[model samples]
Target: MESKRSKYILIGLSVFCILLIGITSFKDGFLNPLRSGVGYVLSPIQSGVNRVGTSLYNGISNYSTLRSAMAEKQALQERIDALVEENSRLQSEQFELQRLRELYDLDQDYMQYQKIGARVIAKDSGDWFQVFRINKGSADGVQVDANVMAGGGLVGIVTDVGAHYATVRSIIDDVSRVSGMAQQSGDTCIVSGDLTLFGEGRLRLSNIAENGDLKDGDRIVTSNISSKFLPGILIGYAADITTDQSRLTKSGYLIPAAQFDSLQEVLVITTLKEEEAPQESTENTEGAQTGA
Candidate 1:
């Protein structure tokens, strides 16, 4: 019975809605004022709802756009950082390659000498590499008095060695001295190091014969009679050559071929000066035997 009553109420409401629509269609209908009053009450409410919906839609769209822009910005920043790191790595590699090429050319310049490459591992106090240690030692055939070379010319001699490391005293050391000769004039001179004067990147050249032909810019090399240094190895260029006050000898400065301010890698010539003399003696003895 309750179901029947609800069915009847729904049918009656549907009929009433159709009749109300017909009545409202007539312009002179009795409900015209009532319809107008209802419209006036609900119009503002409907407009307000529509405005709120539009605002919500616009807000959602703007928020999505901002989020996308932020994501893109973050990605671009990461890309820029990666590119900067790559550029730095490439620059470091290029510099290392240039240094290696210089060492290779130096090796070719003294092709007659057998050498082992070694890296500088430590140093004494001061700005110059006046005294430093190398990674090679007696285990690698490095020995005391073995010549150490870098930067296109002679750098130092190995002074001490252990099983795994060796110490070098460069030509710029305070007590270092070399017997050098002018390559062009065949005149001998003394090349001495002074840590104080090497601040200007030059060594001392003195005791040259007064009548010697050595001049400014002449090439100087290790003399043949040098007890320790190998013969014909370039030391540096003569500069500021002047005659002594007594007219007995000439003294001047030498701009060293090697730069001692920074040392990273070097070549250790395993050949000892003492060993060379014995080889020459042996060759002489063989020649004498052949003549006999």
Candidate 2:
């Protein structure tokens, strides 16, 4: 019976607390000072929480905007790099085009011979460029012993020919030789290349007559005695001349007019000189018998 009385007392206390809160809410005049003070203290805490939430939201938005901006910047940088590369390529192409135009003008000035314009395709596959391949070949009328020129000067002679390509032995090659004459002095000499004498930028001009009047800076040109190369093509310029050990002939160095190392486009003379035919056999034999 005592336990049952304790339970009833606890239930009565809860009912009194509920009635007090209900009356405070319904009656406007029941303004308790303690409750009002507690609410005033908590209002500042609620406002502070709201401010913290708003600041965090703004910070997140700003961070997202910064990330997007960085991505855009990276994209723009890539585009700029691409544009720069393209601009460089176009400039190089323009320079090459200008160079080819100059070559074309030089070719037109030499219209006496049938010429075929060809690009240098490859250099010899060895340490030295003893031979170089041109884009023109038998199909283009290029043949062995054809004269090859670049930049208004003789560069080489075609040594081998294929259907679509031809190989030229440049003037710098050791095996190449040309009959040359000093334009100013009228001194005849043989222009020969030696690999060991390359770095000096010169070719050997030997067989100069002891009495020849060769001087410094005399221009050398292909002589009429040259069997393969056409006569009058510029070979090089004469340099210092010295007597041989026996003093039988004079030898000198020649500065090649054509920059063989930097050759790009060359013209190949395709037409060969027609040989003169002998007189008719019957008429010649009758004249020879009468003279005998």
lDDT of 2 by residue, 153-208 (tens): 77878878899998888877876778788877777888887767866888888888
lDDT (tens digit, per residue) of candidate 1 on 121-229? 9999989998899999999999888888888888988888899999999888877878889998899998888899989889999889999999999999987777677
Q: How accurate is candidate 1 locally (lDDT)?
A: 0.86
Which residue runs does candidate 1 get wrong by more than 4 Å? 1-63, 278-292
lDDT of each: 0.86, 0.77
The RMSD of every model to the true structure, in order and in angstroms, is 10.7, 12.5
Residue pairs with clashing backbones, model 2: none
Q: Residue 258, candidate 1: how far off, in angstroms? A: 1.4
Model 2, which residues run further than 4 Å from truth? 1-62, 126-128, 273-292
Q: TM-score for every candidate vs. truth?
A: 0.75, 0.71
Q: Which candidate is the best by lDDT?
A: 1
Please give the distance, in angstroms, between residue 174's alpha carbon in candidate 2 and its true position after superposition.
1.4
